[model samples]
Target: MHVSEHIIDIRYAETDQMGVVYHANYVIWLELGRTKLIEDLGLSYIQMEQDGIVSPVLDLQVTYRKAMRYGEKAIVKTWIEAVNPLRVVYGYEILNEKGELCITASTTNILVKKDTFRPVSFKKLYPDWYEIYVREQKNENIN
Candidate 1:
């Protein structure tokens, strides 16, 4: 499945009082992973917005596996879990440097008009972007 990896060095600021990575920090990392995935596909979220469309997260699901301590490197592996005309699902795996999964998550996003915040089918608003995602999914057999 067209997976993209982004390395993140855990900073002390991201930890909680107990010194382990906070639960909410994982969500931030997920965003970084998603951004990296888009970049890897030669697409930019900023560019999409510039085209008068904004993709907003409609849902998020996260599972914490193991606690990560400070000063460790984490790798976020992200991919398109599913892509439909109106909805897109992105999956993620956050693993420690040793390849142990620390967290797993997924998010559902839909494109909408920025001003009106009304849902718009990707096929109608961003045909090229939609076609590229379709091609990627078909090539990777990730339907």
Candidate 2:
């Protein structure tokens, strides 16, 4: 799959009193990776929203592995895990500077109408974007 890489410069404010990263910050990093992936594909989430389709996370799964400390650099690797008419799942791994896994996660989202909050199909509303999603999930040999 076409994985997107995003580097995060951990800050003291992102950590707990023990210097370990706060759990909620990992979720922010996931979004940064997702945004990078969309940008890499020459697409804009703003544009998608402008089209009256809003993507909302339906579920989130996170597993914390090794603890990440403040001042350490984090590399978030993300890929398109799956995509269907209503849902898209993005997978992620947050690794420390030494490439040790710190966290792994996935976010499942659905496209919905901004006005009504009714679920919409990206495959139907945004065919071109849907095709790109399909193509992005095809690199099995990379991992």
TM-score of each: 0.92, 0.94
Query: What lDDT would candidate 1 get against the real structure?
Result: 0.88
lDDT of 1 by residue, 26-126 (tens): 99999999899899999889988887888899999999999999999999999888787898888899999999989989898899999999999987877
Clashing pairs in 1: none
Displacement of residue 48 (Cα, Å) in model 1 is: 1.2
Candidate 1 C-alpha error for residue 128, in Å: 1.8
Q: Model 2, range 68-95, lDDT digits (tens) per residue? A: 9988999999989888767788899999
Best by TM-score: 2
Worst lDDT run of 10 residues, candidate 2, spans: 134-143
